[model samples]
Target: MATDELPDRIAEIFNGSTIFITGASGFVGKALIEKLLRLTNLRKIYLLLREKKGKAPVDRMQDIFNNVLYDKIKSLKPHALSKCTAIQGDVSQINLGISQEDREKLKNEVDFIFHSAATTRFDDTLKYAVIMNTRGTMYMLRLAEECKKLKLFVHVSTAYAFPREKILYEKAYEPIADPQQVLSSLNWIKDEAMQEMQDKILGDIPNAYTFSKSLAEALVYEKAGKIPVIIGRPAVASFKLTSSEFINHELATEHVRPSPFAMMDCRLPVFVTFCLLRYPQLKCLSLCLRMHIEIY
Candidate 1:
């Protein structure tokens, strides 16, 4: 749906809510933030971003808002732009590296959360992937647990996380391995040793990224406790070079569907299509999930 055309159900769910998000600089994260900022009346959105390369998280957030995705809101719903705040944090760290003040504020005020940060590189080592994807998720869930008003926690994974399955199902399935144990073992292992043992550890899995993501989802299911958790597994889609190229690419394939909030609780999957490149002010879709989601 376009920003001006969000459904009542979605609007109602989001109205006046404070949302905390991880991986706001990534493809799906940008899309999700843009959609929420423009499509609804929200209280606030706190995006967790680590200070890196000498750029502060707030500076990086300004660059994100300068995107085409926020163009319409900048001109029309200008106040919406002000609702986005950047918090300095790293998911790979304990407590996500959030300051004590910020952490306490989020615990008391956040109404929703989205965890999208993960190590998706095929060449990434198991040790690194576990830290970012598996332990990162565990950390986010812990934070979500503290939120006094949390309604939902959305965890983004990949469709190919379970590569060995002939049919991809949407329910909680047993993870390939226990996430807690794997995370604990990272203390003594080097990246090289993990890489050498990757095949033996992953077995039928294709890559460290997918394998870690599966374990992350398992952690969410097993540890979310009272918080409603939705696992989103989006189908694989390559980055398109241009709008016409993206359209042409889409025409070349038919399996992809636009789905937003498909896995909210146990609700049936729903497709919600929105374009990532149409915004003239934005230059990247690296944070976009692009709606091809299967929620568990």
Candidate 2:
């Protein structure tokens, strides 16, 4: 396919597909939704979001529609708003904390799932990380299996899942700790005990975020033969040429790591991996960039 025909070809697969996206309120998740809603006219996008502090998912999504980023969506297809639906759910909980009715609605109809909800905090305790990142993924996999019409389970993982080794490549890596052991122990470990074991548990791995993500990837890999799943290990995310928001340096700065030697003016690169047999059309990009940098 010609380079110009690539996007359209990639979009064809999702033209009528039903997509369930977790962590839709997150930075990457939001961008994924914007592209889907604007480009392909996806059949339905079930947004799995935790009811924030007090607001319901619908209210939160409405607020999203009002944001400047969605101005293009509004102008393009004002009536297409009905194609989107927000459901209250938590990634770390069984059935995503959705009611039986809502769970059925998704399991029976959704075709693809993008799992992105994660506790990205570096200092998160092993217990919380296991619950949210490791166990949470197990639950998502179970849910994906229930989707009779499901075609793909796209998991958003981190490149640092392997840590800053001398060299990193486009292949799967194993986790340091026993994921099953850590998951089983989560129920019994107190918050304070987990906190104490943080350094010891993660070991050579950088932090709880990376450790949990690594464990989660292991879980997804272990189930590979039985399911159609793809793990996307993304590095740091920043502005893309097609992104709606003007490269907002201030907003993007918080996500970048802070280092004394880091350059402030370099662009990041992303590498994305996919299962060609399953999702032949879509393009995946894995992003890697400095922690502290200004984007133009």
Candidate 3:
């Protein structure tokens, strides 16, 4: 019998490490949790979940496991999931809205931190965007700095964070605005005025989310000294996800939306996924989700 090779990147980082993750409920976040549980023997995954809809964080974590994403893991390493614990907190609040005890615990015990919690809403107001994307980053940075044995702080940003440049490369640039200054100005700038000036403020950037992400990138880049920080910009594109395609093992590589490309299949015999990292001459940035698919 032959077996597919495990993704070494997953094991090299997550194996036997206590990971503190912020966005466990998001699409990418859930997939990450599944991959970690499936591919490696991790120590623990601390999900920073806030009590919402009158439900506890642990209860919500259970609902997350209920998703089909965890089906295989639920069967294979049934006890592997026992490593995951819920840390009640919100990213949009002070100190990620975590209790002092939990914060100190993470600072002491956690080895890896993944911050994927951000509002990707294009139409969100500048006020809210700054708080969620920009300020939320600062809060995570503060916590990352305090970790005694933190190895890496992986921040999930967007390729569109720098929309001004057509040929975007991997490098940190000067921030549009100081995050601290943006936080202070949020106190005084009325939402109405902010809306009016939003276009001018973002300049070539399209939405408030990207603009705030650009600012967040700068904040993360500056703190590279305290911790080994990586700003992961996923140019993940949306597919024409038809109902039938979702069930059957079929993939369409049609140039959907002229930018991002996503291929879907029922299963992958061997997970060999390749990413299309080319954005030649288009204003539309693509989000590529390379998934393992079985050819029927």
Number of the top-ranking candidate, with lDDT as the measure: 1
Superposed model 3: Cα runs more than 4 Å off: 1-10, 237-296
lDDT of 1 by residue, 1-296 (tens): 79767556655667899999888877677767877876678899999999989999999999887755566567778788789899999998987999999999999999878788877789888888888999999889988888999867777778777777777765676788988789888987777887789889988788889889888878887754566666667775333223453345445768864223211111111112111112323221112243432221
Of 1 and 3, which scores higher on lDDT?
A: 1
Better of 1 and 2 by TM-score: 2
Summarize candidate 3's per-residue lDDT along 1-296 as a digit string, tens digits.
33465456535545688888888887567766777777777798899899999999999999888765566677888897898999999989987889999989999998878788999999998889999999999999999999998866777778778777776676676666677788898889998998898888777777889889989988888776656666666675333344454335333544433211222221111111111112212211223223333211
Tell me the spans in candidate 1 whose CA falls farther than 4 Å from its real position: 1-7, 237-296
- Alpha carbon deviation, residue 15, candidate 2 (Å): 1.5
Error of 1 at 221 (Å): 0.6
Instruction: Evaluate all candidate structures by whole-model CA lDDT and list the values in order.
Output: 0.72, 0.71, 0.72
User: Residue 94 in candidate 2 has what lDDT?
Assistant: 67
lDDT, residue 194, candidate 3: 84
TM-score of 1: 0.79
Instruction: Give the C-alpha miss distance for residue 287 in model 1, angstroms.
Output: 19
Query: What would the per-residue lDDT of candidate 2 be over residues 41-84, giving only the tens digit for each residue?
Result: 57988988777879988999887666555666678878766888
Task: Give the best candidate by TM-score.
Answer: 2
Regarding TM-score, does 2 or 3 come out ahead? Answer: 2
Q: What is residue 244's positional error in candidate 2, in angstroms? A: 12
The model with the greater lDDT, 1 or 2, is 1
lDDT: worst 10-residue window of model 3: 268-277
